[model samples]
Each structure stands twice: as structure tokens, then as C-alpha cells.
Target: MIDQLLKMADGPLQDLLSQSGMSGTESTASAIEDTFGSLLKNKAQSGDLSAIKEMFSGSDTSPQSPVIQNLAGDLSSGLMDRLGISSEQAMSLAKTALPLLMNFFNQRINEAPQANEDIMNSVVKALQGGPGSGGADILGSLLGGGKGGGMDLGGLMNMGKGLFK
Candidate 1:
């Protein structure tokens, strides 16, 4: 699922990186991936379905909520410091890439009912946070079996690495 999301965002992300003069760098790509992964993990840990829904709804024209705004700000600062870009460029990249990424997920969910249910179920399970609390387990189940079978953590990690590459 992470791989699919990253793949979907690759073109637009590349374009954003290019605009910031950080194009074609694997480290930059990895940072972007990490930022996204962190945000999703935080949301899963929080167990707030409505917050997650609002983040990915793709229907909010209003300003981003504080949680998202803070994430974008932090991401921008990190990118700016790491990649030697101006703050404006970094913030622009974050602002642009985040919405694009969310919209991609929204579109995917809307287009596939099974996938939508599976994702929501995974989110709920992650919130439960007991034996199978990790995002890898949730995403692994989504990728492997929709029946909530055993998680392949290694496989999920490898898939995430491959996506960044």
C-alpha cells in the first residue's frame, strides 16, 4: 500500500523536487518517503479515524488543520535544512506534495471499494495496538491477504525500500 502510494506520487514528487533544485537525488526521495511514513504512522497510533478521514478526504478547500499544518511545517524545515533549500521552497514542496499524495489515496479508495474497506479495517486494527500494532502488519495484510492473515514485516519493509529506489 505504501509502495502504491509512493508510486502514484512519484511523477508529481519528482516535479516538485525539480522545482526545488533537488531533483534526481535518492536521499531527497527517501526524506519525502520518510515524512509521509511518519505522518501515517502517527495517525495510526492516534486511532482517530475521523482525523485520518479528514486528512485524506480530498474535499477540504479550507486551510489544513493544525495537525497537518504542523507536520507540513516540520517537514519543510527538515527538508530545507537537509537539502540546503530555502524555507519557501521546502514549504511549497510539502504543501504541494501532501495534498497531491492525499488526493491520490482518496481517488484510489473511491475507485476501489474493496481497497477502501481493507484500508479502513487496517487502520482500525492498528489503533487496537496489541499483538499486531505496527504499520507493517496493517500494510502487509493489505498487500498480502485481505482476510487479516499473518504479517510479512520483512516483505513490507523491502517493498517500501524498493519504492524509494
Candidate 2:
């Protein structure tokens, strides 16, 4: 299950790594962390009827949507079902895994000699948005979207950029 989740992330992970100057280690770390967050968010939002409908019902009917297909195949079946993960379990797993993943991701970002804000923004948006749809609220909460709190990607990015020559 974890392998499949990792596989699903490979392309995007490579894209971010190549474009953003993140090292292989950093890319793996970011991908793992992001995947963990996505798992939690998807689980939390599993029962949102409207979101589910939107996911299933496309705006256009021009062949099967690859994004939707991957969501169902990789996320819903490969990761979720294989692990038998419930929302609570997913939350618990994320809590345990996030710090480790962040360490790896941050280490790589810090190693880079240059920083690109646009790339950073894209990565942040992708994390916030999850795989296919919905899940933003769940991720926001998991990422510190509470009173006087939110995931401070800006600070991290700035710090990383500063470390570069």
C-alpha cells in the first residue's frame, strides 16, 4: 500500500525535485510527507457527499479523467483499502510520520543553492488541494489551521532561500 502510494507520487515528486533543486533525499521526504497528509485529508473528507459527487460527476464527458482514475485506483484502492485505514487511523499515522517526512524534505530544500518562489507556491497549492478534490479543510486542520496557526510554508521557503548563495 505504501509502495503504491509512493509510486503514485513518483512523477510529481520527480517534477518538484527537478524543477525546485530539491535533492533526491529531499524529494523522497517531501513526497512521503505529502502522501501522508493526503491520506489523512482524504479519509477525513470521505463522507462529504457533495465532494464525492463532484469527484464522480465530471463537468465534461470527454473520455475518462485520468486524475479521477488515479484517485480511485491509487488512493482509494491501493493505499486506503490495502491499509484498511479509517480517518482516525490516518490521522494518527500522519501525526507520527509528519515530523520525519519534514526533516527529510527540509534538509533537501536547505541544501539547494537557489530558491524559486513560483515552484514553491505550486508545491504549496498542490499540498493544500490534495489529489483530486475536496480535502482542503481536512489538510488545513491537520497542518495547523487553528487559532493563530497555519502551515507556514512561507517561513520555511524564505529560510531555505536565505541559506543559498
Candidate 3:
């Protein structure tokens, strides 16, 4: 599973590695693993897994709500800028992170001795229906109702991909 994640993160992670002036090799792999492991551990301890999935995939939970879309776009852009990642790198990272992260978490969640379908279903429902549905509203409120407007995550992602090249 780690191998698969490494494969997924390879492209963007390689770019980040290069940008950070780290040479590509086993040593770099060790360093990268160390960094990612810390992040994963932190998120696992304090984060919601389904929210992470929604973040990466840009899936719409509420068709009538453009709020999530806008929120996602702003979050993506802000994160990219703050991290000094190019748009392309961010997009690729999103593309890679969501799947790789999801698989990793799903595996862990599954392997939990007491894991059950009911728990998983509840999680999925919450992701699709609860306060999670208010991502757009929460983000909008944070931005103070500025005019950046409904998130065009798909367009922004494509833009990032284009910018990278």
C-alpha cells in the first residue's frame, strides 16, 4: 500500500523534492517518507478521513450548493500559494493524494478489529449530507463574502496542470 502511495505521490513529490534541492534516490525516499509519515500521522490523529476524500476529489455532495466548490477552490489555491507549490504541482498533488490517502485510510479503517459496515456507512452519509455539506458556507464566511465566488475547482485544477507544464 505504501508502495502504491509512493507511486502515486512520485510525480508531484518528485517536483517538490527537486524544488527543495533534494536529490532523487533512496535517501530522498527515506526523507520523503519521513515527512509524509509525520503528516499522515497528524491527520490520522486529528482529521476526518471522509473530509479528506471530498477535498481531493471535488465531488459535489449537494447539487444545489456551489459553496463547496468555491470553498474547495479557494482552499486549493491558498494552500498552493502558502506551500509555494506551483498550480500544476498542487493539482497533481491533489490527484495523487486523494486516491493514495483514501486507500491508505480505508485499509487502516478496515483492518481495525471492530470496524463495521454501519460505522462506515455513517461516515459516508456524514460526508455527503451533514455539516460537511456546508463546506462552501464555512469557507465563504471565512473569506468574508468576497467576490472570488463559487469555486471552479475543475477549471482551477486544469489551470494548475497547464501551469506546471
Candidate 4:
């Protein structure tokens, strides 16, 4: 899944990364992608559904959002390590780049139904190995998993209004 994500990132996301002033364009983009992926996975594994829900919930993806702030920090830390840049530079780049990255992921996730399925599986699996947790149920509802139903991310946003509240 992450490989597919990186392949997808090779185009516009890469350009976006370069535009964001990341020092090592190609490597930094890969690192950023990995950081975001790991963030999602770790959040799921930790049963931090609120954070995950907030991220994908579509209310906001800007740097001001708490989830995005954390994402930026994570991306900044990665940039610092990988590019040998200072914290200020890394954070400035992260702030400039994160909304784009979030929008990219949202678009990619919408276009790729399989990614949505994969996420559902990950969320369910991570939430205590499945089924009993609200993560599975909310995810099922979010993705419309059963009964010949599937929804795009926009649809998820609309239904999500009722989901985590």
C-alpha cells in the first residue's frame, strides 16, 4: 500500500514537495510519505480513533488543526533527520507542505477505492484485532463496507457528521 502511495506521490506530490522548499526533493518526499503512513498506522494501533477520525473527518486539514499540527511536527522531525536541516527550516517547510499533502491523500484515497478498503482493514485490525471496537463499526459505516455499498471520501465526510459525534 505504501509502495503504491509512493508511486502515486512521484508526480504532483513530488512537485509540491520541491515547491515547498524541501532540501532533498526526492528523498524528502519519500520520507514525508513514510512519516504520514506510519502516523496513521501508529494512531490506529494505539486505538487513537479520535485523532484518526479528526484527520480524515474532513472538517479541516490545514496546519491549524491539531491533527495536522502533529503531522507537521512528525514531518518536520523526519525532514530534520533526513535532510540535516534545522528545526525551524523543517517546520516551515512542513507547514507549507502539509495541507497539500493532506489534500493529495484525500484525493488519492477517494480515487482509489482499494486504498479505502485497505484503510478499513487496517483500522479494524488495529483496533484490538477487530470487531469488538467502535473503530470497526465506525469504519464500516464510514466506508459503507457491506451490502454492496461503497462511498467516496466526500460521502464519508457527510456521513461522518453523524459518526464521531
TM-score of each: 0.60, 0.28, 0.32, 0.59
- Cα deviation at 67, candidate 3, in Å, is 15
Identify the superior model by TM-score, candidate 2 or candidate 3: 3
Candidate 2 Cα misplacement greater than 4 A, ranges? 1-82, 86-88, 116-118, 122-165
How many backbone clashes are present in model 1? 0
Q: What TM-score quantifies how close candidate 2 is to the native fold?
A: 0.28
Give the clashing pairs for model 3. 67-136, 70-151
Least accurate stretch of 10 residues (summed lDDT) in model 4?
140-149
Segments in model 4 whose C-alpha atoms lie over 4 Å from true places: 21-23, 54-60, 108-165
Which candidate has the highest TM-score of all? Answer: 1
lDDT digits (tens) for residues 52-154 of candidate 3: 4432332334422343333334334544654566777544444433344344344444333322443343233332332222223222322344233344666
Better of 2 and 3 by lDDT: 3
- In angstroms, give how far residue 93 of model 1 lies from its true place: 1.5
Off by over 4 Å in 3: 1-75, 117-165
- Taking the tens digit of each residue's C-alpha lDDT, what string does model 1 give over 56-119? 4435423375555756886787778777889998887777666656655555454443345455
lDDT (10s digit) by residue, model 4, range 25-101: 77777766666666655666777664455534334476687776777787788778877889998898778767766
Say which prediction, candidate 1 or candidate 3, comes out ahead on TM-score. Answer: 1
Whole-model Cα lDDT per candidate?
0.58, 0.37, 0.39, 0.57
